[model samples]
Target: MEKVKRKIIKIDEDLCTGCGKCVSPCAEGAIEIIDGKAKVRREQLCDGAGFCLGVCPTGALTLEERETVPFDEHAVHEHKKTLADKPEYNITMKCHLCGTTEHDRPLLPIKAKGESDWVCVKCIPRLIHG
Candidate 1:
């Protein structure tokens, strides 16, 4: 396959708080939180659809034009299958604040706040300070 200049998702590690808000929005399973940083596992899995952009509170993700490998739907399917086969992938919980279900653990347990609800990492500040 010939390389092409296309839009791709870029994550600035310095800006990413590993809130994990971008992961669930990426239907291709491209973005993942590794070592408390959001990373794109595979460039081919990103479709440049910008679905994960709006949810990033820290502005860590951006679409950039670059000459690189093109998006591959087949690869995305395979990646998703690999992820689905993992035991950890089966563990999912819903965020009480946003009602978004996620495979990862909730960043904050709000039991100390007199509420037995879990808040997603991205919404932690709002739930704590607001």
Candidate 2:
């Protein structure tokens, strides 16, 4: 089958600090920082919505157009869940209450509709009770 053309985001090695700040938001698991630079696993997995672009503070990542290997979305979803099961770096913003790591915690359950970015459920009360 012919590969699909998509915009893949690559982190400039010279610029990335290996902060790992971009991993959680990527639902496709396309971006992984290796040697302190973000690398796209497969362009086909990337939707090119640029969500990672906004989260990156270092400006190390950028989108480039090219042909990419095709990937099944359903398969990617299954893969993401598997990866999530592992105890990896937590990306969710810190919880306000107990000062716990939010990691992959869902945003809605942790905070008001739009009060703050996603946090942990444990901190929700403090955020709300306060």
Candidate 3:
């Protein structure tokens, strides 16, 4: 595996907010949210095409000519396959009432007054008692 100077995505961690807004537009799945920041997960998967650029709100992503591996279409397809095999929405929900994410507590799906929402366990007491 030889490295060469080529254009690749440069993610400025100082500006990235881990919003995950730039993840989807990258058809190659080259970028991902890691530890509350946007990261270039694999240099080889990034095509340096800047397709993920406009979706970024923070202007944290940029293209620069640097020493890196060349883009590989094979790796991108394999990466997408691995992702597809995973359960859908494993990242799941946020409490509709207070924005409490399931990352903090379990979210239960419920409906009231013809509206449905995901509510966290702590919020359940308030919903029932109020």
Candidate 4:
């Protein structure tokens, strides 16, 4: 019988800058940055590859052995889809005018609120004058 290894990923929320440096490295998409902190959303996606832990510059991520339910690849993919629909707390964009923080790209001329401008909401004022 093949021995199934238990895996657990621990992230130091205090050390995490919410940079999301670990997200892409994880093939399973087990880790996500929520509210500016790295969190292991599901153990099923983690193959214990130590990819995320190694990529963390602040040493915020560490993998430890622990008792966990068996890893499920299917469930992991499903979980990743659910995460995609949820708002990303780490999403950040630069304002073209004031150079302040903007969360995401503009919706490309959505008609909401009688908005006809294509610029991001933060840059709308500058666009009107320019």
Candidate 5:
């Protein structure tokens, strides 16, 4: 197959902490934590929507145009199916406080002492600042 220039997710290994925050935001299941680092499992599976970019606290993920093989829809479908078959694959991310699964707003990481949790952007002031 001939390579073409297209947008794709790029991860900076030096910046990534492998926190697994970006894994759930990716609807395509293209991102995975391997060897304590975030990796793009398959280029074709990434739609380049950049949803994962929002959840990355370390700013390790970004989109860039590069020459690569065209996205394969068949491969994406297969990859999704494979992920779906796994019992641990969860698509919904819920707020740690309100127990709601809605993610329409940006999420913020709140850390106190040695523990950390994610709060939706709407709940930041009420939950953290207050």
Candidate 6:
């Protein structure tokens, strides 16, 4: 693939805690935890939309424009298909109470104030009682 100047995800290893928090929000399956740190798994898979930015606990992920592989939509589609079978990548919803994501644990379906939301097991008691 030809290198093109485009905005893509950049990971600062020093700031990355290897929490894997940035993995779930990436719709393209671009980020992955490898060797205990979050790394851009594939340049072509990253659409440079920065969807994974707000989910990071640490300031590890950033979008930088430089010469790199162009984002491939077809490749991302194929990648997502493979990830659909994986349990970890399946759930992207976060806990409405604590903001915990499926990357941390499976969220349960609940109705709050006639609105549906996802909550983690740890917060179930709190949501029910209060």
TM-score of each: 0.65, 0.61, 0.64, 0.55, 0.73, 0.71
Of the two candidates 2 and 5, the one with more favorable TM-score, higher being better, is: 5
RMSD of 5: 4.3
After TM-score superposition, the amount by which residue 32's alpha carbon in candidate 2 deviates from its true location, in angstroms, is 1.9
Question: What are the per-residue Cα lDDT tens digits for candidate 5 across 62-82?
Answer: 899999888888887888887
Q: For model 1, what is the alpha-carbon lDDT of residue 42?
A: 73
The segments of candidate 5 whose C-alpha lies over 4 angstroms from its true place after superposition are 85-88, 95-98, 103-130
Q: Where is model 3 poorest over a 10-residue stretch in terms of lDDT? A: 84-93
**Of models 1 and 2, which has the larger TM-score?**
1
Per-residue lDDT over 1-130 for candidate 2, one digit per residue giving the tens place of the 0 to 100 score: 6877776676688877777767876767767777666777655667776667756666777787777666568767766776765444345555554556545453322224423244566556666677
In angstroms, give how far residue 91 of model 1 lies from its true place. 9.1
Q: After superposition, how far is residue 17 of candidate 4 from its true place, in Å?
A: 1.5
Error of 5 at 79 (Å): 0.7
| Residue pairs in candidate 1 whose N, alpha carbon or C atoms collide under 3 angstroms | none
Q: After superposition, how far is residue 15 of candidate 4 from its true place, in Å?
A: 1.6
Best by lDDT: 6
Q: Which of candidates 1 and 4 is the stronger one according to lDDT?
A: 1
- Residue-by-residue lDDT tens digits, candidate 1, 1-130: 6889999999999999998877765778888899999998778899998777766777788899998789999999888887876543344557787876665654443444322345688878886699
Top candidate when judged by TM-score against the true structure:
5
lDDT of 1: 0.76
Q: Which portions of model 1 miss their true places by more than 4 Å?
A: 85-130
- List clashing residue pairs in candidate 2: none
Q: Which parts of model 4 are misplaced by more than 4 Å?
A: 1-5, 80-130
Evaluated at residue 62, the lDDT of candidate 6 is: 80
Per-candidate clash tally? 0, 0, 0, 0, 0, 0
